[model samples]
Target: MLQGMRLTADKEHIAVVLNRPKYAGNIGSAARCAKNMGVERLMVVSDRDYPQEEIRQMSTHLAADVVDSIVYCRDLGEALSGFHYVVGTTARLGLARGPVMSPRDMAEQVVELSRKNDVALLFGPEDTGLTNEDLRYCQSVVSIPTSERFRSLNLSHAVMILCYEISMAEIGVPERFTPKMASSRETEGMYGHIGALLQEIGFLNPENPEYWMMHIRRLFSRMRLSAREVRIIRGICRQLSWYLHHRG
Candidate 1:
């Protein structure tokens, strides 16, 4: 039996989000992985009921507390609402999907981002991975390297690999001070404000707003904007709104 595995205060900031998971065993195993890595929070986005007994059985003693405290959300957006940096895991890739990184690279980046922001690692269902709509909420995507013959990994295995990488990441003290980055909520508000301004300026087509907005999101997500930068952008939006009103 695994003993003395406990959650820490810092681990609370990193949440493992399972989106529309299909099986109870996977959920339990994932919870076990989270506990093993010291991540206490587990967020589930599922509209259906799960087998509680099986989940507990699979989780064993490693993740009973985490499974017990799982936060249930109606959708991916709600699950990721409070996070500052959201990383989605997927096996597939496409042009519309944003940049994809290997697990190791993503872990290093996540470790740095987690310094000042609440970070979330998002996993899709057992069958189909996160849909395009779900990926829209994520700033980055990570794929675990596997043999080409059988690329797909089990849900719990994926979680374990990611959690292990994150746990092994060596966070070093920075020589210079840096400002805190904006939270997901704040950045989302700025996007909304920008969208409104774009509509008013006749820049975004009401019929196809996504074409431009997706690229804009990708651009900004890559920049990893700080809180001060987000505020500056919001200020710019406010000025534009004032200009439009005065010119009328």
Candidate 2:
């Protein structure tokens, strides 16, 4: 980890923000993308629930640490606070929104601005996308150039594209060796507890426990759950179970 940091000499800094994403799988995939691209910080702003099992599994082992490191915010204002430059991603251009640049152009701008001050890139949710109000907070806007008819992209794919661009820009020099993957010990127990909880809640369904376990294994294998994060999630499940069991 230290070596990876040293390799960059800290040339570029990036913060990826997910604004009120509607799906858990997107969040998980985004985490994996962020990790793959060497993005260090991830902020999630939403009132909706996260798809922990789906995301963890989708990210595979590569992005597990990022899932563990996620920070959740209730509002976009809180998510963008303390950052000097903010960039928002959108597919549609509004009369009020600023000029839309390609993702590469956005990355270039980020590199330039980052040389002067800190920067954050924002991504809106799945269904409604970023509202006009959401664009108010950004200094600029980036639009991934897709077909005019189909400009929309999955939130995780967008995150991956931007994070990769930024990471490549920051790590200008080639790395001699690939970075290490998170250790199995990091998320193993959490998966076990979650599996048990799912079984308890009937979220895991199969004719045979073995078949169900295999399905669970394939689904959660992507999460790369950390010890602390697993503990926290398991605690949530435990509390919910207690409430349900005792509820009148």
Candidate 3:
């Protein structure tokens, strides 16, 4: 007799997010992996219309029910909105990027985070991993360890590895010392406010604001500011804007 699968209540707090996925089949496969690992939510950030027939066929019965619950957004920021913590997956690293942790390390953190907050695991498109712009919204990036000969892994395969590790890991609830962090939407707004202030102060040249803004994003992402912390930063930006307008 085939054994029945057991489900965990805690899995409902975690979500898998696919950023600008090019293939419907991969989305389906990712959904299947999420369901198998007990994660109940899947969010897809893509502007392209995905073929329903192809996705359903690929998902089989394993995740057929989950297909209906999948949330679709046109951009990464929208898809990530409201999540308390966001973990992005990347295959490569650079000096400009935020700290990168191994999948195992990330799994430990994510398991604990899921206990009290909505946590997201982000996967980028198949052809290219998350761009610098796309990664700005991610608080941390998780890199899967692979042989130096070849670093690329298929989108679904990467999702399976992360979900599998998360499912098997044993985590205990610890005393909650960490305050609630800012949501992706709140942090994005802070960046926008600060960017505008920088432009006003002529710190960011209008002709080439992106160059400096990219560096600013990396710096603030590393700070992992909490909601109140972001509010304070925005307050300073507002004061600077006011000062520039009223200077004698």
Candidate 4:
């Protein structure tokens, strides 16, 4: 299901890292935005108390999966690790930082980076943006072009806008044929193929299959694998299986 593929977290490589977000409602809104944009992983780092339960409750049915999947971190650096590139979203211009780009330009750069490595789009707390220390971790800073007089946006609004821009970038790729939304059966079959391959490669340990499956899901969920991409991936897996079986 192409539509389902777009809705699932398996559609994007981007992860949202929230730094010291205060309100549970804000977190819930961010989760919803993440779900809409197919963002799978949500890393929240805060020294202060974050109402996890409230967020889960407020996320409703749409963001329930994302709220449940959130990972809590002690600090920004720990949350940002393993990501190849990081972008800090900010509205203010600092004396040291360079010029800001619109969401479209930023998303273009993000799409390029997504092809190569894991990317983290960091958002600071509602009241204060990235601290000087937090900024150190990002490779680049992104500012959504807004009216010069007023630029600040709600945390969830910012996330939604960023995701919309990213989605727009991938809307029409002439090289790839966009199939109609794949049915649940089709998706399940595709996942089965991937699971079998992972088991063969020892990524999904047979002894602790369930444990390994969860980990594997975490990995693939972040990729936001498209319907067409899933088919291509399964084909590769099949070819690998054929080669392995015939070689002997």
What do the candidate models score in CA lDDT, each in turn? 0.84, 0.67, 0.83, 0.70
Evaluate residue 63 in candidate 2 and report its C-alpha lDDT on the 0 to 100 scale.
82
lDDT string, candidate 1, 48-116, tens digits: 889899999999976788989999988676677788889888898887777799888888777666767
Better of 3 and 4 by lDDT: 3
Point out the higher-scoring one by TM-score: 1 or 4. 1
User: How do all the candidates rank in terms of TM-score, highest first?
Assistant: 1, 3, 4, 2
Q: State in Å the error of residue 186, model 3.
A: 0.6
Worst 10 residues of 1 by lDDT: 1-10
CA error at residue 184 for candidate 4, angstroms: 37
Compared with the true structure, what per-residue lDDT tens digits does model 4 show for residues 93-179? Answer: 864444456778777767655654577889998998877556655556788777777877899999888878877764322244422
Q: Candidate 2 on 118-165: residue-level lDDT in tens?
A: 567899879777886676556667888777777768888888888767
Off by over 4 Å in 2: 1-12, 170-248
- List pairs with backbone clashes in candidate 4: 1-181, 1-182, 2-181, 2-182, 10-224, 10-225, 11-224, 12-224
- Native-to-model Cα distance after best TM-score fit, residue 224 in candidate 2, in Å: 39
- TM-score versus the correct structure, for each prediction: 0.89, 0.61, 0.87, 0.62
Candidate No. with top lDDT: 1
TM-score of model 3 vs. true structure: 0.87
- How far does residue 112 in candidate 2 sit from its true spot (Å)? 2.7
Instruction: Give the candidate number with the greatest TM-score.
Output: 1
Cα lDDT, model 1, residue 197: 96
**Model 4 CA deviation exceeding 4 Å by range:** 1-11, 171-248
Candidate 1 displacement at residue 185 in angstroms: 1.4
Regions more than 4 Å wrong, model 1? 1-10
